[model samples]
Target: MLATLLGLDHLVIAVRDLDAAAAEWRALGFTVSPRGLHSPHIGSANHTMMFGEDYLELLGVVAPQPHNEALRAFLSAREGLERAAFTTTDAAAGVAALRARGLAATGPVDFSRPVPLPDGGGAEARFTVFHFPREEAPAGLRVFACQHHTRDAVWVPTLQSHPNGVTRILSALVATEDPAGAAAHLARLIEGTARRDGAFHRVATGPGRADIAFAPRAAIAALARCAEEALPLEGGAGMVLPTRKPRPPALASGTAIIFEEAA
Candidate 1:
């Protein structure tokens, strides 16, 4: 049985230089936040350029020439949005469902470690993640997710400063040639409904939850322009849902996110 997954969390845009890409986000009016170095575990270091509770994480290889294989593969794809993240209640069960669908999938990988605290003490923050193996999903549609041990309050500081009009992620705009097939496959794995709308496939879960719209070449190109800087990818390009409001200037090149909240 497929485990119950909650909603969307974050999205990743693969860039050539983390610093350069982060700079673009800063130029667009957000108080870009700190960088998190997740080494020895995820194989690459990333700096998050924050906006409200959501963020645009600039990820790159920081080690030797072409340092990490996974990072290299993502960067080599060249200039575009890379992956979309979904929130799940059970990472282990999510993995099992993907495998049952015949897609190459991996663990509810854990990220729990002790880090120095401000009080001169150490604390542990735990997390879980899962991903769709490259061999199975198309280059661009690779799906992965992360869940932190911290409460929504402790970890989501960006939300406090988020402007009034902004709300949670409504949906992601994914560009895939096989919209119908992708939607069908995803519907089986996720707790949502997928519908074919011309060349795009729109997928969404509960009300006020995340939605993903899969488009083709032209649409993808149109959305890529919204990115502060392109972070080439192996698959087609598109936008992640619930962009920061006043909307990042970088997103000017993409489609506007539309949705309504419960009264």
Candidate 2:
């Protein structure tokens, strides 16, 4: 049987300075988690901000290794929402299904990191992940799948509270030269469909899941009145979060985060 495509797992922001990025997130009213170091092969580390079912991660390469060459390359070009991961229960099967569909989805790679707790104890958060080739992704986007083996270690109760009152992601945006084509391609990559509303190509993931949209990078740049190259793919790497109260817009790594009041 073909592996089913689950909803979004988390969004990753590739940063040059791990601690500074985490600090910025904290200052933005998020309750950030302590840093976690990945295996040497991966050569990366991260800090996370949990939001109930999903979360956001600030990823940085701490040690150079073969496995993290792509991540290093991403950091060289820019820093922002570098990758987006979808949830999957069976990563091995997910790869096979992608291959059967003629997509070159890579391994169910296993990795883990130590999660520190407030009670002077720690746990390990393990995961099996697979990747879709960059060619299959739309412009300025990288997509992957992740299967969490230890969910509690990640969604710890103490880290769930955010002073900003943000509860969940409402939508994610992608900018491409050809949004119509990109939207269709994105839907196809994630085993979904897309519908066009004006310049936006919207893909509804599911109930309680963030909606994804693709638009023209040039148009977004024009509307923002900034140089096209000023932002990553014309500010395509943006997300909407519903907060309990209004907060001033936050900007980091050229990505502007606009928080809105909860409905």
Candidate 3:
């Protein structure tokens, strides 16, 4: 009983200053959403960049607490891609499936936050999240399954358009100490298989069929066009974006986002 992959939900980049991070992304031609605060208990806030079905979340601590201590520690160390979230239609069932596969999983925790509507009204965007055990993930990255209760509240059409001409996230690159082992773990989690591509291990999924590449730490630097000294040894190293035209990759919040011409 392997867990099914329902495609990517959203990727999170944790930052110290939310406004500054949002501005940085805006300068890079992304249409960042207005800042939204999480529930008081969660003590976090975010600005989202919606890209049709998939999105990117720039998250920051609004008020720190014991619950968010891990997030705080991540921000304290550095700002970058911290989490890779996959979409799941039924988070509780997803958790159960993973547990049956002998994988450690926690939560189908329900949470919601108010989102402002275009007509000056507001709606609560609800979610049930299934979290993977930290030990199972490659270092510096957290993987989880997210089930959205109010999809309309988050994927507003106006937020999908970007000035940079980016249409979709084509792939994500993960740098790991053991690429083969990590790739195998990902394959099992997604209930899909992995294949070797040079020194990289690749997994493909969803309607868009985006690729997830697991590569050695040294190889990731070269692929991202960043110096080895600057890139983190583990976690999300880069993303492949299919754009209307060719554009240079941008390094934001310590992640390399490469842009490619759409077919």
Candidate 4:
């Protein structure tokens, strides 16, 4: 198992139309960041909804490039929750720890994107990402560790206030055929303990304290109000958001997001 301490970073939602997706999120009462273009080499763009330390990223492919072929394919197949990233202070150490556990990691690759600041200026947000081998990652899930070089540039207080009354992310729900097996794998990756709760297995990482639950296929389908086949095999099926009062689950680009009353 990896030894690095990981915390929830952000969730990615892939969309076909960036403008429409942003507008939809706004209508749902979220404050979204201005569109940010990835480095010219990456061929992608994103708009983010900031919520304290963790946020939601709406990703779209603006240009086709070999480097972003995987993202392009994900968009072509369907649009919804595509990836979940965790935070690490030292990405190199995190990769080393994963490698020590016999898990293949690609790199602590450094990248940056220009983000439009609320004050009408541009600031560069830098990041280093450590990726796991597709085969070793959780089934139907794309997970990675991210180390931010410029935190202030990404999480501005002015952009975090949302009209939907959401304060923070609580959990990401994953539907899988084998909840126990999936939970075990995620526990190892996050270096956390997994416990069974009925048909769901919950793994809680430190600091962020957000739960990642692996639920039985039927249970998740019921929660999402959709057919089981409509959900991703092992991908994020829904998200739990903390709100002042209970709000019904909302569907965005095929992903179900539940808003629960904050404790």
**lDDT tens digits, residue span 119-141, model 2:** 99999999999999867766667
Compared with the true structure, what per-residue lDDT tens digits does model 3 show for residues 87-180? 8889999888878878889888877888887788888898888888767775456788889988999998888999998877878888887888
What is candidate 4's lDDT per residue for 1-263, written digit by digit as tens?
24555577888888999999999888888898999888877788999998877889999998898767877888788888877888878889988888887888878788889988778888999988887766655646678888998999999888899988887888888878898998898887777789998988888766655778888767877876777777777667778899886677788876888888898
Where does candidate 1 clash, by residue pair? Answer: 78-232, 79-231, 79-232, 80-231, 80-232, 140-235, 171-211, 172-211, 226-250
Model 2 residue runs over 4 Å out of place are 218-229, 234-236
For model 4, where is the 10-residue window of minimal lDDT?
1-10
Q: Runs in model 3 with CA error above 4 Å?
A: 1-4
Tens digit of per-residue lDDT, candidate 1, span 1-263: 13545655665666677677666655554344444555455555565533333444556666644224655776665644566666667778778887777877777787653443344554555678887675545335666766666643224455224332434454566655566767676666564678876667877754445566766655554544433234222253544434334443134212222323323
Model 3, 168: alpha-carbon shift in Å? Answer: 1.3
What's the lDDT for residue 217 in model 3? Answer: 67
Query: What's the CA RMSD of model 4 in angstroms?
Result: 1.8
Model 1: what TM-score?
0.72
The lDDT for every candidate, in the order shown, is 0.55, 0.79, 0.81, 0.82
How high a TM-score does candidate 4 get? Answer: 0.93
lDDT of 3: 0.81
Give the least accurate 10-residue stretch of model 3, judged by summed lDDT: 1-10
